[model samples]
Target: MNLSHPHSSGTIVRCRRLLEPALREVVSGLHPWGARMVAFAMGWAGLDGREQDADGGKGLRPAITMLSAEAVGGTAEDALPAAVAVELVHAFSLAHDDIIDRDELRRHRATLWKAYGVGPALLTGDALLALAVSRLAARPEAMPYLSAALIELVQGQTADMAFENRPWSGPDVVTIEEYAEMAAGKTGGLLGAAAATGVALGGAPELADRMWTMGRDLGVAFQIVDDVLGIWGDPRLTGKPVHNDLRRDKKTLPVLAALASGGPAARELAAVLATGAADEESVRRAAHLVEEAGGREKARALADRYLDSALGVLDECLPEATELRDVCHSLVDRVS
Candidate 1:
């Protein structure tokens, strides 16, 4: 689970090197104002337009894209367009997600909307998405997956936002099954597209469907791990305030699983959540109850299950892709 293991790290670094120039070239097509905003969003520069070594992201999506191509006997360069497209889509999603969630911090810094105005940030997100689409507009083999991802992403985001209005318990409560579907869409779609497009562009078009399914399962696992971290991870690493999800009433997997236990601790946790208070002590207590009710353990088990499912597909389709497997494993095992 060492994400920085030499092999996987080398793969990521190599893919990133290939992706950066192309990403920069595409982003450079924007107007200066939009370009500056995008540069900030991509962590290439600070709000002052000075370059800073910020946490851009793991570049995992693009890495996955390139590796999928390589796994199928195609050079990483063959999937470069797909890699860059997924990365831009990722950035676009984050820019809009921050605005939708009203989250001010991301990757240990101010979010795009926080640094820039919401209107500009929204437009910048649109611009990034447009560039992403343009990258593969002529690639009929890969474009369909990206298009489907956009649809799924929107559907998932809408469902997640709608969940906020649902009851915390009883018949109308958001179920685990529902959460899985949402995660598969919101978080998994782009990952799926990355793999699908990779295989498609890599001359293994027939394997694209299976890889898409693999990425979706991986996405669910990734999202569940993210839920676990949002509640318990150190802010220094996660770059998010403790209990921020709880404070926002986010329908996270851990909290939902905890409330479903139907035990004493679960009952207590329900009462705490029903209070609708976001006080530090309350949220801390809620987090403790989630762990006490075995929510964290359930979440971990579920993540492992999904990760295993994804790896099973990888094994069947591309057994030689050891580095790609490691990267996928690292996604669920990541601390940040």
Candidate 2:
């Protein structure tokens, strides 16, 4: 993290403390029991699914749901069930992501796929998905929206996987569109679902549309920042390759925009991406391209843009939950 962001640590601690327990309750007690049971399916036994889910990263989606609910004049207690539903989906996504990416680490530990292999990982993810449905069914009133959200989540993952199978990179026109679509699924879709669910849980059907838009924008901003850190962040902090995104030819917002710059950086980025599945040498070379192409500055600007827009929606649509305004801002400003 930039030393300049003095208050980031405190804010992260505060937010996590406020959110962690609530997440635990929902998952442990069955936020959506159907989904948790899915996590426990026979296939999951081969993969250590329960352990991974239990020891996963921050429960951001569910926390966001609870915060949104509270910000909208609803109680955290009322939002707990929905929170569980949101998190079950998130955990399943992560497990699958590990397999698809062939990644070994998550939350600084061996990813499910790494420990159990792709087959078990797939089974684990499937169980969790089924459990999510079960949890939604438990809340008959919320089932329709919850189930729809889960479907959307799957669609997003599908799009993401489809893009990874393609061979291309950098800010070429096709690459840009593909990257955006991939991100929309892998990132934005879930946030949209969570926000929409929050509105539904709060009995604010009229506001679900607005909240969905806000959440989508927030997801975009969140992803942009993540890409930045994936490239330039502290290795000690993020625990991944310094430029993992670059190595994957990720075509992230910054890299794309930089490629769009049509500068020397763009040329280098294009060249490196043109040779996909890079090694450490090539990854460093591609990052140099990002810097040369003005990617860093552009990524920051794009992230700020969506964040600002989301904040605007929050102000207009969630006036009752004014505290969330500050909290969400902190999410953007904080360096992970």
Candidate 3:
């Protein structure tokens, strides 16, 4: 069953309708081979280059960018450049992540690196990142925010990869504080840029800092919710195999929380992880251990806390942020 959030459904639909055309136009301008790979990656084209009316995710980042502008008393059109730029950056990251994770599928289809060769797919990601930065050239004021966000994004991804190599039961373990910082870098940085750029475009340069705070908190909440889904979400909804993160041995927030508990269940969970290859039964047992150790609840509470902070900042900075708040709540409550 689809997760329902009646208050935000119509708004989400409207935002996607407004954002799709702009995204398509930007993608259509890429070089032929690069365009084909990216289009395939985005579900907009088949491997054979036929057109497809694909469901290109929730368009959450772009929608948030546009909404941020509206919150600052400006029209959605004012933030279009920032919205497109961030969307491109997001796609670029996904293309690279698919390669890094060795993920064969994304959005229920073959990943770019799987369909095309890894070399081409990597180049396609590079092209997309270049396009994303180039798109901001017209808005010189937005450049600094995007540049800083990109740097943090790279740093976060590097840390995430390094975390995977650390022994699950070793002394040099990943801590909750370190995980939070990585989450902020990997996920929150771009979100902060999106809001800040939108605010600047909205003619409220003074409120840009506040919007960055809102975006960063929301981004942290977003990653936490994503971590929850990685462990417990239905495969039909999330478009991946069941117990996906466990199978990959990803060091997500829930798993880290379980490991930190130092209780019997947490110990068992760590032992299971140490085995390295997480078959279905092992994954199921590990997930149960995480829950037994209160990891799931702890992760949920952390997500809610960040979301509350984000909403509080939104309320203080923009009284007219009802739509944005609804969207934020809906995102945090998402199952997929």
Question: How does residue 118 of candidate 3 score in lDDT?
Answer: 94
Tens digit of per-residue lDDT, candidate 2, span 61-148:
7666767777667766566667667777777887787777777865445676677667876876776666566656766555665665
TM-score of each: 0.98, 0.81, 0.95
Instruction: Score residue 167 of candidate 3 by CA lDDT.
Output: 77
What clash count does candidate 1 reach?
0
Question: Candidate 2 clashing pairs?
Answer: 32-135, 34-131, 34-134, 35-131, 35-132, 38-127, 71-321
Look at candidate 3 and give me any clashing residue pairs: none
Which 10 consecutive residues of model 2 have the lowest summed lDDT?
39-48
- Give one digit per residue, the lDDT tens place, for model 1 in 32-103: 999999999998999999988688986999999999999999988999999999999999999999999999
What's the residue-level lDDT of 45 in candidate 1? 99
lDDT of model 3 at position 186: 90
Q: Which candidate gets the maximum lDDT versus the true structure?
A: 1
Candidate 2 lDDT score relative to the true structure: 0.66
Model 1: runs farther than 4 Å from truth? 1-7
TM-score of 1: 0.98
Compared with the true structure, the alpha-carbon lDDT of candidate 1 equals 0.91
Q: What lDDT score is found at residue 75 in candidate 3?
A: 85
Q: Look at candidate 2 and tell me the lDDT of residue 299.
A: 87
Please tell me which model should have the higher lDDT, number 1 or number 3.
1
Candidate lDDT scores, in order, read: 0.91, 0.66, 0.84
